[model samples]
Target chain A: MKNKTNTKKGLVKAAFMSFIVVLFLTTTNCSSDGTQIVANFTEIVMQDEFNTEGAPNNALWTYDVGTGDNGWGNNELQYYTDRTENVKVENGYLLITANEEEYNGSSYTSSRLLTNGLFDQQYGRFEARIRLPYGQGMWPAFWLLGENCDEVIWPQCGEIDIMEYRGQEPTKVHGSVHGPGYSGGEAITKTYTLENDRFDTGFHVFGIEWTPDYINYYVDDKLYNQITPADVTGEWVFNQPFYIIINLAVGGSFVGSPNAETVFPQTMLIDYVRVYKN
Target chain B: MKNSKNLYLKKISVVMAILLTTVISCERELSEDAVFAEFGSNAEIYTDAPVGLTDQFFTSFDPNQGANTQGFGTDNNEAYLGSSSIRIDVPQPNDPDGGFIGGIFLDRGQGRNLTGYDALTFWAKGSTTAIIEAGFGTDFSEDKFVVGTKNVVLSTDWRKIIIPIPDESKLIQEKGMFLFSAGTQSTGGVGYTFWMDELKFEKLGTIAQPRPSIFNGEDVVQTAFLGAPVPVTGLTETFNLGSGVNQTVNVAPSYFTFKSSDTNIALVSERGVVTIVGIGSAVITASINGVPAEGSLTVNSGGNFDLAPTPTRDPGTVISIYSDHYTNVPVDFYNGFWEPFQTTESADFIANGDNILGYTNFNFVGNQFANPTVDATVKSNLHLNMYIPDNIPANLDFLISVVDFGADGVDGGTDDLRQQIFFNSSDFVADEWSTLEIPLTLANRSHIGLIIYENVNGSPLTDFYLDNIYFYE
Candidate 1:
């Protein structure tokens, strides 16, 4: 068994090296089409690979506890706590797990991790690789809110959803932008459907290239949607800096309540979160 | 061993050969200058350029005609993109009469095609924080037909300014001037100097057209009592195009064409005002730009106040008093007893096959029957059909109370008896209709009045409809 494991590791390493060589060669040469042949790379501004063990880095992440009124104003049913069982870092990944338990007068408990007051940026490429949780009432999201959230509140503070997946719709994810006029059900959103496999089956890279004039959404390097100021009814408020938030919500108005078929102890594994700038 | 080594060498050679051939073929197609350019550089890529202005005017704003008083000069020291930028010195706010007005006018002779372009992009920096008003017009004269105005803030650091053209249709093949003006009044300080560069028009993809959401007034059901003022005007018709990040467009009543399904029952004005003309039901529809929203309007006759039919009783048999039988008081009233509760007459989940009064615990008050006199000693049980909607929170506790008016004939006079009911018990099934019977003999009041329903634990209740409210043996 030891020999077999070593051989499997060797094979994986060789395949990864081959893929790198191919990408390097293709990116250097020009194609028949008139599309730009420049190398697609940017300077890394911030990154979190979750290489540490135990709790998240105190300097990078903070927690938002308790249930918001009306399920955090979304009719959600989970109590957020700063428990290790709900959020922990291990094996070079961050895990946000939602468990079915009676705690704090809620049927379930989860964690909401934020980067407010720690890290914020104006415009760049915001991305993450995540293995989503699946089952009815499971809502895991990697999104951003304006740094002025405490002062202006939601919608007015602006929100940029890099990736949001619902357990009920296992095969699709949503990218949306919310502001004062275009918030709630009226937010400017676009749906990206997985071609063959569900998002929970494996990790997928979700990214958004945000510029002053436009914001482009991508899944696995494939551009799926783009939004501009004209697409929205209100002012383009993305010019200001915004912080990040990651959470695994157990039942909200967006995902509805879980039924008998829905399983508990659903976990969302995040491989990394990286930001890049030109 | 020699053979195996040779095979491995051959495989490596084959892979290298394939890679080399692909690279050479691609390199052969590149131009001489492109071949020597630095690798992974985006500068050499030939992306699509802005329409009409192929020259880019990287050096200067050509044909720049404006008032000579405003200082304009070309500066090679500060450039946003290329080699040179335009520097303009603005006078102090109080320096010129009628406000300082200066601009750079660019006339292409023939109108440029700005159809695909949504906005003009430029980079600017000011000596101090100031406002720069820029726009385009048909001509340079005073009567020049200005298309739009863009009020942009210029900070000390360089920033990109995107000015959305108000009306693109006005730009089709017309002589136009791209202009900018800065003064003390607009900038709120002394006149300052500014620099601008990289003037171009960009198409930032197509804008998604969002469907409009129309809401008619506050509630789904609109109620107007008879003998009320004609043409009720408080009803508001609102339309939202996007989440309302933008200001919601308040469509005037004149903009909407109103129609009523039964005009004889309710006459609806163009502004969504429903005048209760008769005692009947009508559907009031308010339409704007072909989009329509409907609301049901029920006009109750003033003379007939009872909501339920009279119940028959035998001697010694307990008299059954239904909530719908109250005549002297309004169905929904706030007589300084509790928080106001909105009551709606609903046919859904009715126990007696007619209409039942449904209400939710909003503003802390539950359902209350004002000045209701019931002898709890005779009718020992207060029976009512309570239907809790699925949207209500689970494990919630509710209170049923009977307040005695006593000699004062007012609430909170002497005694009040209250009972608690847990929603999660077997007596209540969420999402389905159920019956609840509370014993009134506990109170046994001489003058039992003011039936009050409340959330015992003070938990928020969304929707709980009740019917067949009565006191019986």
Candidate 2:
């Protein structure tokens, strides 16, 4: 009987030890935070210098069937495609090129990248260093949208435009935010110029820091705009997880339809992306 | 018994420790959120007012005036040189392309400047209808220009329209005006009877007008501007020597004549700064190289002033509101107006209020005016309305105002101008309907309203049409 009691006590002690071991392992691997260190997950998933033929690997993005007949609400000419000419990673950078072609019903072709199912985050910093195209009618953008966008409409789901530009103004880049109350023409935006050559010549950094309180946009390290809680009056669509999107759209509403002056094969180059947390 | 009790206690203690660790770790993880920053540089805002044609401050609309020449209208029949030197017209068969043609030029001089003063106002009126159009160009070839331009719809009864060029810094300023190519090029379109009058350029007055170039001599004027050299600094240094750098480039030799190389006496750098290289003094043509660009420079011995002085005209004043708050607001008749209405789902009425324009010069009291409402989002057949008061006169003059106020009072305000228009009411309506079609270039996605004040003689009437006013950047 005494022996039986001893065995029972020993079993209980063994169970307790196992539980403690598992708890310690979890704490060490995850730090004090609940997020486990994703071995290969880095802030930047892709970068292209346009120095080579194709864009970086794993840059597989999706197309949005725009709000209207045009590709999205922009009424842009270029249709997003998976072809190497539309997008490629080479020469140490990623390139989204707009070429004159017939695809879907549009006369122009380009590539759009999105981390939709590949990578997404609830709240984090995202940025892309890119070089813009020149001339009239060309448009380039790096932005973010809510992950569950299929269920929700645009602007209503919220959009964080880290960078946008037109070929007419080859030297300047704009950062903005759009939502239900302040979408489209009323979007909050600020412009920044390039430090080196024109945007078409070399790559420049375009980034955004989105949080519950505010959103900060930058060109290189220069902070051009900040969107506070007060800036948003509609649904707090930004609170949910969002994925990254990179695209080069042909002429649409803001830049107007591409005219004859606009040259084909306009390219946008993207460099590395890095993210840090406190 | 005591040992068993102790064992149970140990088990409980371990469990509690594990739970505590798990909770703390989760809290820590929350702090490590991801955020990102953008990259780029800032361009300096050039607010300095330009003075001479030799100044590197203008970009020409057409560099190579080829076959069709840089004119207005569409591809098939453009408005080229007409019998009268001042007019460019659209050949009949009026399609979208072959309409009117106009151009502006910039002359690269001492400074790397191409844009113009902030405010640009001109006096223009149509001989026939109130429909006139305008666009900016960079090259003479139809392929290199910004086409599909719409007019501001000026009055046929002799009125003045003023427009403040947007982001002058973004303009190819070397030498350009806000170019207008009026009259419809659409098929079955009635030819244009409009004539643009007195176009003038003025410098925006600030603390001190940046000092003008000190001298104007046959010899290249030596200058030391305050800022660093620009992208295209010197016309002589940048151009190919084989292309006539050793000859004189006429500034304002004549309006429509293509400049020719005489003695290789003139040279300019890509920076736009010019230098007289040889002896003979020929007119050094200065030109702005982008849409609505213009430039004139003449250099000769004995310091002869061959430079054609810019025409003088009235400063830019406001025009009448096209349409806003469609209900109970008066739309101008003499000036002519077009406001389409639409029905859509998002157009439901809310308690807060509708969009209204509010600039420093204008304001509104909350609830003082009843909220104007719009319909929901829809595809086709949706529309809004604007009413032109039947009380309009045969001849008229006025300014328009509009605003769209958003919730935070940040961008909501009046004075949202889409384009600059020039017209007269008499040409459109001798005694009957004053029909005019004007285009709103930057109307989408903006939060603002309109205000129309009649300076000559008029009163507010409540009728207008509107539709499909959405927001976009």
- The numbered model that scores best in DockQ is 1
- How far residue B66's Cα lies from its native spot in candidate 1, in Å, is 99
Worst 10 residues of 1 chain A by lDDT: A32-41
Superposed by TM-score, candidate 1 places the C-alpha of residue B194 at a distance from the truth, in angstroms, of: 78
Worst 10 residues of 1 chain B by lDDT: B38-47
The alpha-carbon deviation from the true structure for residue B386 of candidate 2, after best TM-score superposition, in angstroms, is 70
The prediction achieving the highest lDDT against the true structure is 1
lDDT of 2 at A168: 73
Clashes of 2: 208
- Cα deviation at A6, candidate 1, in Å, is 57
DockQ metric, candidate 2 = 0.01
The chain B TM-scores of all candidates, as shown, are 0.34, 0.24
- Per-model TM-score, in order, reads 0.34, 0.34
On residues B260-346, what C-alpha lDDT tens digit does candidate 1 reach at each position?
777767776653555656776666555544545434334433322222324443324544444444322233342223312433222
Q: Candidate 2: lDDT of B51?
A: 30
